[model samples]
Target: MDGETALDALQNLTSAAGTNYSIDKNSDLGDMYFNMTNYVGDTLKMMCMMRSHHMLTDVVLQAGSEQFHAHKLVLASASPYFKAMFTGGLKECDMSHVKLQGVCPTTLARILQFMYTGIIRVTEVTVCQLLPAATMFQVPDIINACCVFLERQLDPSNVIGIANFAEQHGCKELHEKANQFIEQHFTQICQEEEFFQLSAMQLVALVKKDALNVQDEQDVYQAVLQWVKYDEENRRPKMEHILQAVRCQYLTPAFLSKQMKSCDLLKKLPQCRKYLAQIFKDMTLHKKPCVKERTPNTPRVIYIAGGYLRYSLDILEAFNADDKTWTQLAKLTVPRSGLGGAFLKGMFYAVGGRNNAPGSSYDSDWVDRYHPVLDQWRPCSPMTTPRNRVGVAVMDGYLYAVGGSSGSDYHSSVERYEPDEDRWTLVRPMQYKRLGVGVAVVNRMLYAMGGYDGINRLNSAESYHPENDEWTPISPMHVARSGAGVATLNNCVYVVGGYDGSKQLNSVECYDTEKDTWEFRAPIRISRSALSLTVLDGKLYAMGGYDGTSFLSIVEVYDPTKDVWEEGEPLTSGRSGHASAVSFHQCVIHCDQHEHSLSTESSLGWCSTRPSSTLSALAGSALNGAVPEPRTSGVGAVSNSLSAPGRGLPDGSGPSLPYGP
Candidate 1:
């Protein structure tokens, strides 16, 4: 008891018999009092039902034509609003019926049901109608519950309505939740008609985030254009304002050539033309489009392992092709020269390189894994044969180490490393004992391409079927390239520049997997052998290699869309004979400098001009294993571009409630 209550009790006892008698302390009295209250609750429930059976109805909540007969005490106890009106000297206390405003009778019935049963079926159809009534009655618990139900129903189709409704009614939690959902799914959500329904200020706020989950400002362009096209007569006045937010410099050239060049909206808005001019000027100066970052998914990363610069070194590095930056990773356990690597299930496996020390079996069979999360390498079982210059590819959940040299011995033997089993088994040997062969995965099969069979540079290529445990011969390339780099893009295997026995080669050939034929495309801008190749951001990359006499730090990118290859930002430190694999991370470091630079103005801002964008979507960026469908006339599927940040939630309410926000 509080001090005031104790003092009052003493005063009351002063006049009682035996004033000095001690008081009895009963901790178990709580359960007794609870039982007594339960009896009172049962009586109250009985009274609440008396009016239902037409026994003694003192109050009626008149909802529409239906009159709900109820006792004043039950109604007052259940709702504070009812308590104020019925017992607080209001005329309604004496009245037979009280009509509720701004809420349907059915909704009121549901509220009453919750008061009695402590549960209500919350549905999308009813939550909207129920929230306002719950708020009016000061039912914060019910308000919080209904808000949660509304949040789970949020999607591209209804989030805008929910956001606006929640804000207007002061449902702060719901408003915050819906707005957060919009930001995380801006790319896909903006494509929805519901997103276009946002007020001018709301849309502006959403489009102006440095960390928007879109690839570039061009996505912002497409989103704004679609919104304008919904109702050009009304939206045209805001065109310049909206388009001004879009950074034209970040748009693909295909969009510039086919769509922006023919835009009627651009001609009408001179300010938008200025935006385009700035992009062109920047490009002329070779300044990359200043986007703060990509958000739709974890950015695809390039992991480089084992290369030769002045000397062979066991160096590990990561190249983010998008931002054109590089990060040095954990070095191999032992220095390995010409070791091959592959990214499998979120880890980098560096295998089969010549040990830094000179000796027999200097071709170390040891295999070590670089866990990106742990930021360190741990040893796994070694290969069946000690070899260097092996080409590693993942197929059917196993890493296939293709042809490479063991000391002076050229190996046609191919082996598969099973991650789950932590074991390596020799697969069917290749048809040819070739050293320095390149391997890539295309169409679910492992293709081992050009290499030296010790006697001569071999143009012959073979495909390994993991299911059958066999190698099937495929058509040969037009030229021989030992120590070549290989990649699969657009359903074809591309063999880049390599040694042709006579000299370093510059010609590039793409093999049609379906046709089983090799066709020449454009040659590399520079002739290099022993380079690393991988596809990133829907473009082919040939990076860091020796071009006959000198080690090259050159970075070349090929756009199959434009049928050309231009220079990209070079690696921070380039070395030849490096093994390259497509790993994944949040963003690529800019290759030119290690600086984390992003443009503020052009990156993200309110759109105040007509945006320039192609009506068609481009092929979505690649994911783990498969290439996406070609981009046609509109934006493609939700690319694996942005990933959300980590946050913790409260217990039992599920992952979404207090966390994963």
Candidate 2:
């Protein structure tokens, strides 16, 4: 043979025999490996050719009016549906022809090609048909491919349709992506015809989500009216039930009044009119709405509200840990200092404190609930007695407002707020009257620490069991403290910086709820009283308060593991007697009000201003599993935007007895 021809023959012979072997160099390990580099590719290519030419074909898949010739072995190997049909004693096991009832012929052909070639083209035009067939045939990879294609094609015009499609086919990832898209673009989506086509249940589901992104609650109210007005004769009955989805309590009294007078449908439906009237009455009476419910992927924020600046200020601000910056939100309903604050359910309640707004100089019995998503404030059923420098804690879904001064006398009385009833009932009183008390709940028991009891700053502590409504004394702290910040962590209640009858104290102590014993921990760097304590990311944060000389803007973080204190980002302004609570809120970071792309991967730290047509590049990057690290500034980043800090709620009240003035 010629030299070139002989070499070619030899190489072909070696490749065909599959004798490519590699040996391990380690003498201790006796191992050898042979790899056929293109074996899988070659086999799949040969099978594809055979199926296309109908050579050695074992089965015919009939979908609609077309037939696809494919090998039983290849089809069964690639699809669980075919595997069960051929091997699970089904009649189709012996049959040469199989009929797929609901699958389309075009979709079947593509699926069969994918079974042999491991490739399928999915696009907007083909995905609608392809996904259902792939789902029926139990082809998860192709189904996922179709879903990914649909997700990219989502927008206000088509998201509702896509969400319905995903829901019907039980595609969970696609459904959630579409639902989140709906939430981010509710105002625009409601204007679309597809939103009008939604059934009552679907409409209610969309409107009631706390994550529904709207600049104002009025948008939701208007949308509901539009939906009902679309087909008044048929939909008017569903109005009362659907109106409940709209947070009418948050709607402006003027807006509600305008709707009641202007809308013909609302007037026609007696039940709808009554519901709106009750909501208006409650709004006027200052009875707040129930606490909001937070969804998954919401951002956790630290809210500091109602502190004394020069006088009692109604300032409300949120600290974003990801950016280490603060954004001023809506002000408190009443300007008050020495307030008690806690997050019950998903709402932040600014409990009893003194309203030091110049002429108004009395302690407040008012309980205002802050809506984190709306950045709005509304009053709830007020406490039985007005209080200042009160202690607050949440236990078993009820908000406890503990002892404080009533502008006349120090009180040991405690009241429990029931959100469902929108009323505060007096619970068991404490053994000692405590003003400026520190309260914490652990192991289903509420613990009240040191405070002033009419005369002296007390060091005594007590625990209350809500089951029997009684208080039992616990071990006392080493130092007498009043206005101390209290927080719970690792089964221990921590008490930080407070006044000890003489001077601002920097001492810190932790009481083990299990052991009922007190032990000292690392003290704060700044000696201050009326500072707010909150736990986040397993660390204790002591926020702004006042020292003996001046109001301090210091923030100290305590680490239990190292037992040390470190300086953190300070507050925007110095304030004392402010209330703080840590909560998971859906934080909307505004960036010039631009739109961005939709990303299905919702994470905690990332912030986007608009849900649609914004962050397009970041969305794709996240889909590819290479999510960029979160930042405070970028193309579409979370900027340090500040709103005005002095907005107050309008005055209105239906009755004065329990709802407060």
Q: Over the stretch 296-363, how does candidate 2's per-residue lDDT look in tens digits?
A: 34455888998876567888888877668777776776677878999875588999876554323557
Q: Give the runs in model 1 whose Cα sits over 4 Å from its true position.
A: 1-296, 356-361, 585-661
Which window of 10 residues has the lowest lDDT sum in candidate 2?
648-657
What are the per-residue Cα lDDT tens digits for candidate 1 across 1-661? 6545544554454445232333445676733322232444444454544444655667778878877777777677778888999889989978987887888889988887667556678775677678888989877778888888777666555666777778877999889877766665576777655666666666677777554655345668888878777777788788777765665555644455445477776676777767776666554443434653333344557888877654456677776655666777656666655678887655788877654322211456777777654456777777888766778887545788887766557789999888878999998999998767888876457899988776788899998765567788999888977777788886688998888766777789898887889999888899878788888867898987777666778989999988798998787675676778775432223333453422111212223442122110110110221222322221111112212211111100001111111
Per-model lDDT: 0.67, 0.76
Each model's TM-score, in the order given?
0.49, 0.54
Cα displacement (Å) at residue 173, model 2: 9.6
Candidate 2 vs. truth: CA RMSD?
Answer: 14.5
Clashes of 1: 30
